[model samples]
Target: MKILPFVALTATLFSSGAAFATEQTVTLNVANATCELCGPIVKGSLSKVSGVLDVQISEADGAAIAKVRFEDSRTNVPALITATTNAGYPSRIVQ
Candidate 1:
């Protein structure tokens, strides 16, 4: 009886946190992906970031474009930039 009410309240509280977690997708322009190897390197870097759900990197016409989906509560655009930049590929969010 009393325990049931407590369990319900706890479940509601935990579930509410899930409601606040938002998924965001962003496209980034990455520099220095001049070869076929660059795409894999960039993808590997972004994939290691926390909360990164998906990463698609394309190296075409000497440009690298990465489309990423992530949970905003655990990561953001800046973190994504840092991950790629640290891997020797500087990147910025495409407006």
Candidate 2:
């Protein structure tokens, strides 16, 4: 029927839009993370954020770096930074 074709077209269009969604990775420099336990805290904070796929924490140059991978459609860099900051680890994007 004509309606069936219309429904199929609509489904295809919506599904195709989802295909454009991208996963982004960014490293955040957490200035307040100064101890060994800080890594887990930072990772936990980032993991709690919606759309965060993965979080890796490492120390470099006396600062903690949190590497985060997330779905761009659901979260952005600012949200990630806010999450860490709210958890007492204020951070900025590593250039």
Candidate 3:
């Protein structure tokens, strides 16, 4: 049997495969963030974490949505959550 060409295989793989490293929207549920007071602290904390691109914390919902551009190699969700928690508000990965 003849083998499939390398270029064709490569194209198929790219079309079908899930992206490993890409900008992803992850929502964070935060505890104890209930006022404008909590906003800047959450923003600063998340900013310190490596590989974070965009962060938006809402005191109304007590949540933070981050547009994170990170390599699983450079950083991860757990680490980011820990950073938020350490800053003050307890946070968990919601998405």
Residue-pair clashes per candidate: 0, 0, 0
Model 1, poorest ten-residue lDDT window? 13-22
Instruction: Choose 1 or 3, whichever is better by lDDT.
Output: 1
TM-score of each: 0.84, 0.84, 0.63
Q: Candidate 2, clashing residue pairs? A: none
Candidate number achieving the greatest lDDT relative to the actual structure: 1
lDDT of 2 by residue, 1-95 (tens): 87999999889978766666799999899988888998998899999999899999889876799889999988899999999999998999889
What's the distance in Å from true for residue 90, model 2?
Answer: 0.7
- Ranked by lDDT from best down, the candidates are 1, 2, 3
lDDT of 3 at 56: 72
**Candidate 1 structure lDDT:** 0.93
Residues 1-95, candidate 1: write the lDDT tens digits.
77999999889988767658999999999998999899999999999999999999887567699999999988999999999999999998889
lDDT of 3 by residue, 1-95 (tens): 24568777778777754345555556777787777667788878877877677777665465544444454545678887897789877877664
Q: Please estimate how well model 2 matches the true structure, expressed as its whole-model Cα lDDT.
A: 0.90
Name the runs in model 1 displaced over 4 angstroms.
1-16
